[model samples]
Target: MGEDYNPEKEDVYLMYYDVNNLYGWAMAQYLPYGGFEWADAKDYLTLPEDSEYGYILEVDLEYPESLHDSHKDLPLCPSTPAHRARNSAKTPDHAEDQT
Candidate 1:
């Protein structure tokens, strides 16, 4: 098939790349109500607390991909729920339960 390019796969990789770029400046926010948001680059860099949103988590591109594997046993992408849960669990509120 002459290197069948999958649009789905391409979209995923593009998304991962964008999120990583956002981390380069702004930060990823983990909301308490099971939602996520991103803070402005300036706000994130300055560590502002008046964002009127969730907590900001510093982004580390070197870290493992937030969504690595799939639930279907194949080396595919993860669902929205799975990714959200994984990221949410990384929050301080969730980690505090460990102690």
Candidate 2:
């Protein structure tokens, strides 16, 4: 969906904001506990992002390189954490002590 997005362009500007409490902030939010019921997708689609209800959606996504340029500054979707083995290839962050 990179209609006119181009990260390689000279005039493009980027900014990074450090969200110190992003997960912590969301953890502190108010969430519904019960009374969840199935609703039609069409009806649920009409709800705004900041709607007063919580939802769990099953969506299929198509992420392409062109779309990366459009969303390079920020992600278009939230990342679902991947499960990996602790003994897998290690970057410095995960490397064992060299001592």
Candidate 3:
């Protein structure tokens, strides 16, 4: 805010969603149990639609430099907890904020 900034003279827009029991609905989905096994490429490639064999897929990706100029302040996606943040000296999400 500048020296001439005024709260009453300005319009502050607050956008929000009114979702009830959203977390509870998501938690009601089927969850994995027991031990997990390393599946081969073929097993995952021809996985059945109803199967939760490869429910999650983590990709080692690089954010494009072309878009960095506009989206630098925002995190595009949730990063893996084990790997370090791209081009940062800070540790992964397990400890502290990458910022």
Candidate 4:
């Protein structure tokens, strides 16, 4: 049987965009996950305050289990409670009806 794919085991990344240049770029890392603290992305704390420069995107790079297991020491970004609660409140069912 073929091997299973695990998204959580994949590498995570933070992509930065250049609005004026109309392009984007990503950092290079050997591990599947970016070697950064979770707090940097949680709570929108690390997000750029300015809109002109563009924004950051969190991406999960799906890779083979062998590769994922090789770099298990890499740090994984954390989804904070506050971020989860905020997203949960935005669900269509939870959204307020506009009449």
Quote each prediction's TM-score: 0.18, 0.42, 0.42, 0.22
Q: List the residue pairs that clash in candidate 3.
A: none
Q: Candidate 1, residues 1-99: lDDT per residue as tens digits?
A: 247776566234322222447664555654367566665565545555555654645553443555455322344533457678776656777679889
Compare candidates 1 and 2 on lDDT and give the better one.
Answer: 2
Q: What is the C-alpha lDDT of each candidate?
A: 0.53, 0.74, 0.64, 0.51
Q: Of 2 and 3, which scores higher on lDDT?
A: 2
TM-score of 4: 0.22
Q: Please give the range of 10 consecutive residues that has the lowest summed lDDT in model 4.
A: 22-31
lDDT of 2 by residue, 1-99 (tens): 377977667555669797698899899787889999987666776778677886887788888878876677788885745654544557876555653
What is the lDDT, from 0 to 100, of the residue 63 in candidate 1? 30
lDDT of candidate 4 over 1-99, digit per residue (tens): 236756667565665644563233223212233444343444555545443333346687666667655555553543457878876665565555641
Give the better candidate number (2 or 4) by lDDT: 2
Model 2 stretches astray by more than 4 angstroms: 1-14, 18-30, 37-40, 48-53, 85-99
Q: lDDT: which is higher, 1 or 4?
A: 1
